[model samples]
Target chain A: MRLADNYEKNGDLIVTTLYDYARRIANQVTVVKDQGRDWDQLIDDLVTSKYFGYPLMFLLLGVVFWITIVGANCPSQLLSDLFFWFEGQLTFVFQLVQAPEWLYGLLVLGVYRGLSWVVSVMLPPMAIFFPLFTLLEDLGYLPRVAFNLDHLFKRSGAHGKMSLTMSMGFGCNAAGVIAARIIESPRERLIAILTNNFVPCNGRFPGLIAMSSMFMAVGISMASSSLVSALVVASIVITGIMITLAISWLLSRTLLKGESSSFTLELPPYRKPQVITVLIRSFFDRTIFVLWRAVKVAAPAGALIWFLANITVGEYSFIAYLADFLDPLGRIMGLDGVILLAFILGLPANEIVIPIMVMTYLSEGAMIELDSLSAFRQLLLDQGWTWLTALNFMLFSLLHFPCGTTLLTIKKETGSKKWTILAAVLPTIVGIIVCTVIAWIVG
Target chain B: MLMIISLDQLPVGESGIVTVIDAHGLTRRRLLDLGLVPGTVVKTIRKSPAGDPIAYLIRGSIVALRVNDSKQISIKPFSEVAINE
Candidate 1:
């Protein structure tokens, strides 16, 4: 009669008991338990909430940017001193060897100085920033960031995953392009690739950090100033983000289409990031690797810049004359020809814009000093700059073309020349237009 | 019922869990590679002040995606289906 009740085999109490225990063990030990009984519902409810979720995300974002800005300062100054001293020694060695004057000009003045900027300016911030950023990633905070903004991304007609890719863009646009591989729609992926230049990469960050600190945060309290500069960069980054959204919206409605994909997002429990592991991975995997890549490209670029500055065709070298030619257009955008030239040359690396500009303006064939941020500020002003100039420069820098590495990365990821070209060109057009409009309005 | 976001409408702080892995081809694989499985949670961390490819966190990694691409995802809150407690 009990057998008629089912496959229970009720008379076999011992076997039944063992079966129950085994099932319990399997559920507890082998599988991730859904103690989350209605986890799907719980996640959905929280993600969709109109009030609490988004503000928390903004608070976190402000926190991250604040930390990156604050943390990057002291080390930046220290690296600057060490590299400058190295440059001084290298200069003395060149003199002792009785190196040809032009040889000195090319290697010591042009190449080494550029390398120093790359090393000193680019390294510290990345060292301090990447690990901290990685800590956020490790703690499972980022997915929740995407979850909170999914609705906004959807309305913009872009893929939600673009949010994640763009975050990578802040570290380095090339990495960001690689990150774009996360978008599930081909059209959406294309859009992500095209728009990623909006975020300031490490190369671009020096410009942002230099300008914002000089112009915006000159006299604030010790702690306040750092936070202010970061907020400023984040502000530009936020603008780039907005533009990315606007462009994607325009693309999807007109060209790309389909729907936003539905995917599951899991927010892992927050854990203390293992510091040793994080430092090792970030230093080896990201910081040093990026530095090495920059150096490989930068050496050739250094030679090119030297040649461009020194080789005179008529009264000016090819680069100088070209900058002269570009000046009118640059003026239309509230920038001058030299700045435009710097952007074009800086395509190989954004890290050199300030140095290039100083070299071109000073006629010293290279940027000379790194004593203080104030000195950098003085150099820009001496070259016909104003607050409008600084503002426009920041905007253009924030919104301009992807650096050479990023462009190549886009090519690698898309495996298509057409998409890569589109990625490079679209932002330049937007940058010029946006900067021009602002320059006109503010002028 | 599920609502589709046009890339432009996604706000700075909104959050959503994936309801469909609806994108096709390589793009689909791209999402999956970032641990964006069908049941994963997503949150918008910050929008650049100018807005566009807002930053979002997926799984444990931070990724920035454009608003247009987010349009492909069709999501509805659990609260929409269940009575809110």
Candidate 2:
């Protein structure tokens, strides 16, 4: 107890108790005989093999994404239904009390709706994604992932740890920026910090999910839209991965020009993942923390969104006015005011886009029943959405500037206002360019 | 003086002992912790597009180290020179 206390209180890097535990385990670990082995050549043969290496890497990536998509669906729907039902109950109770109309609207519609959306949309996916990702981290597949891409990164003149940072981008760009510390080179780290936004953060996942499900309903079979949405989400994530590689390559040659640093990667031994621990750790550390942040941010955001939709200026609400201002830019990208409005309000969290869009569109249509996917489709049809618009929206979601939280994180991570601004703007530029080009060519 | 050599300059399929560790400080410690030591037999595993940081095999595992870091460590390429005349 005293030793544990000392370890906890002291300013020390060495975790003595943890080291002791590691040492105890180390004794039982027989050193794999260092026979006259040529391990470097062997790993080289495997990773650099013209055919096998990259294909294998892609396979692993697809498999991990597939797992995330397949796993997160059920709980997301259930949570959404449960929360909405709870909201109905609150409204009924408030109505019975004869509470002031403004009080009920402010409390239930503004705050409760926002918090419920945060939990339902963000929780299920993160609950599944973070633990699965933590499993890979625990198995040390990340080092191999870095090893696989090190040469490419070197060619780009970026530090190898950018590979790991990009992987972190899968979960959250903010965390990905934080992971840049693992790269010791300041120049390379800067390059990573700048391009990290190319890998879509969690805020964009909802947009990806909505687009994926809506378009993939091509087959006559009845598999449900959530399943299709999940697939689209996975593919969009794959697109984000491709963009990271491309941008990294671009930066290496242009802004950060230097020789690539070569370094060895050590694959830690794999262990049987402890399920109970994974659940506890991931739930409290990741899902709940994100949920809490979303809830906090969503309160003001929801109130503001409510205010904008409610308060009108000369025949148009604040939202409509803002969208009108952004309409020209939106039109150039083949999107209209409503879509642009959704993206703007989605700055707090991507998960709220569908809900917020539903609310706004309902106001425009005078009604919308969003209980299921079909009704949602009807709402979209009411707005005259097309395949082109959906495609553009997804591309914008994947490529645009990150959410407010992620921007703040980039600022904190880089400690340079200039880079932080670039991190946000570079991707916005890419989104607008690619989106514009596609909109033009497709049209 | 200029020393700009591509990673392919290294003999393919030949194993060499690591002599130095040159990379990011975080990467160096990570490599060291992974059992990369001077005089350890390391075989090149793979090369990426344009080939600079070549992946290597050491002590029954795989690692990727860049050409510059690899160059810092000299190697006596394994060879058999048989003289039977």
Candidate 3:
């Protein structure tokens, strides 16, 4: 007790002395220029103003998403076509080499398709999103966002730095998990990691967008469909944030009990973002790294999926049997058996969830390509989807467990399987509860 | 006698000379890193939308600290410090 008191006193003394020295030097040397008006006044007035800050943030983020959605379309299509063409060439080469049928099925049909799906679907958006976010980071806007949201986080009993991690989660949860390092307190850091998955990452955005465009945009014309979809997506993002705060509050109150430790954050001066460096770094560091990990898991997942679809016991294949088993539970959750099976299989990458569902519904027993969103909608309609199904599916997609790469990141970050397992199970439990409740109510 | 007040109590647009930082170990270290040391002049810039956390210009950086955290550090308003000296 004496030693603890001494330590406390010493800390106080250090702070006093440091302040004293800083004041003395500041008084003697500090100079002011442009006395009344500050250099950053305009930007600060706009960016941090109570009314404008939020609107500006939304507008900027919307612009980024707009560019990503519009810019990524052609490239995504081009890549998909190129990969599919290559698949044909690979099959021809296999036939020429007299490769066995099962070998071709496993290697070419299953693994190659899986790898191609991940690369094509996952690459374009991440390639566009990360660099844009990084550009904002470079401009020093992110810290201001952190600054603005700090109070809410503090009130939630979480470290203010969580705002930064939450924004990073918009790109990828693994990146967000890594970004949690900014939180100094171990307890608060854990809260950040555990709650990061609440935000919809790029991987899940396609699924969310598809559902919103199909259901929410019904009766809206073509031009405004995009706007309606954006609004719906924005609402879902807000819901994710609310859930993040709620979970953070619960964890702080229950498991990680402590005062949310205060930290000094220097709101650095905004500068022009360096485009070249930002692009290269985000491309190689974030885009490539996340894509590579997804592919690694996806290839094996594809092989397993193929085996599940192909291996028939008596009459029904394993996937069909599994979906049948899950059908009752899925109905309670307002999703079909095929949808549930797709989610279970989509464990490797959230990007594959819709594809897996489409594949399952078609009874192809392997992942297949969809020609367009309308065709995808037609498949869902044929499966007997209502607005409730679409809503619940989107809810499930938003709230479900993070992908395999994100799970590995959580394990690596916490260095404790206990926390990692909790991280995985927490969201799944929340997803099931929320979806079930919604389903129960709508019924 | 020096008229000391919690930094959060300092009026908007007024500057203060930090005198004592009465915070726990972790918070103290963090405050110091932000240049909240004794002799620095911090000016209150503005309040947030919710009006609890106030932005203060400290050591050439604009920082927003919640009232709860700001209340831990004691400072003398510029006029009070000038009169005392």
Query: Model 3, A169-231: lDDT tens per residue?
Result: 987898999999988789999999999999998778767766876787788776676666666
Q: Candidate 3 clashing pairs?
A: A19-B37, A19-B38, A19-B39, A20-B38, A23-B39, A23-B40
lDDT of each: 0.70, 0.67, 0.80
Supply the TM-score for candidate 1.
Answer: 0.75
Cα lDDT, model 1, residue A146: 69
Candidate 1 runs further than 4 Å off: A1-25, A28-56, A364-368, B1-85
Give the lDDT of residue A440 in candidate 2: 98
Q: Native-contact fraction for each model?
A: 0.00, 0.53, 0.51
lDDT score, candidate 3: 0.80
Residue A64 error, candidate 3, Å? 2.6
The candidate, 1 or 3, that scores higher on DockQ is 3
* Winner by DockQ: 3
Q: Is the docking of candidate 1 incorrect, acceptable, medium or high quality?
A: incorrect
Estimate the Cα RMSD of every predicted model relative to the unseen true structure: 9.7, 8.4, 3.6
Across residues A1-443, which tens digit of lDDT does each residue of candidate 1 receive? Answer: 44533332332233435545655676787755545425533543454355656555555556666776677667777877887888789889988988898988788767776677677767777787778778878865676666666666777767767878888887788888888777666888888888888877767766776677677776779788877776777678678778888888887887677556544344454466888899889988888977886677666677777888888988878777888899999999999999888888777777777667666665533454855566667877777788778878899998778787788888899899988888878888898999999998988
